[model samples]
Target: MTTASPRWFKSSYSGTTSNCVEVAINLVASHGTVPVRDSKVSDGPSFSVSASAFSSFVAGVKGGRLGV
Candidate 1:
């Protein structure tokens, strides 16, 4: 089963065609889990990650670990 309805928030820096995916804002502290999905596929498959893992992912993004 899927986690939840697909909702998204594009990065402010992303432009048209937005290669970056927008994350679901609904899965905040209450769930203690961060949910992420593709903006183009609203009802598509999504994955959930631990808050700490999510934090690390964000750090990697900022640190250029993912190479943008």
Candidate 2:
């Protein structure tokens, strides 16, 4: 079976820097997870976390609970 490829994108608030991460939300429906990877290394390793968990992480970042 062929696997779906991630449509990766970084946050709009992310500046043009090498320190940002890219995420693909496209798999949430099909895979129930969000894939994340380093923007500086597109061909490097990538991993996925549950949708709810990813949402919580984003919320924490926005709420300043993540401390950057």
Candidate 3:
């Protein structure tokens, strides 16, 4: 098991808002998970989804399948 910490970052398309979603894709290779959290609540609850699931979610968002 890797002891690496998450390196979180928000999308560049999020503009200057502090309320955007943040993701840590760094864990995908080591843990098979993509951690996600709200930028506005840095110390709040966060969740992790499978790497494949996160990739699908991103594809849906980019393809406008989720209706933006």
Best by TM-score: 3
Least accurate 10 contiguous residues by lDDT in model 3? 59-68
Residue-wise lDDT of candidate 2 within 1-68, one digit each (tens)? 33888999998778877789999999998899999999999999999999999999989978999765
Candidate 1 has an lDDT of 0.74
State the displacement of the C-alpha of residue 17, model 1, in Å, after optimal TM-score superposition.
1.2
Estimated TM-score for each candidate: 0.71, 0.87, 0.92
TM-score of 1: 0.71
Q: Pick the candidate with the highest lDDT.
A: 3
lDDT of 1 by residue, 1-68 (tens): 34565356788887787466777666665676777877787677788888788889989988999965
lDDT over C-alpha atoms for residue 68 of model 3: 48
Q: Candidate 1: list runs displaced more than 4 Å.
A: 1-7
Name model 2 segments beyond 4 Å from true.
none
lDDT of each: 0.74, 0.92, 0.93
Q: What TM-score does model 3 achieve against the real structure?
A: 0.92
Q: Give the Cα error of residue 10 in candidate 2, in Å.
A: 0.8
Q: What's the lDDT for candidate 3?
A: 0.93
* lDDT head-to-head 1 vs 3, winner: 3
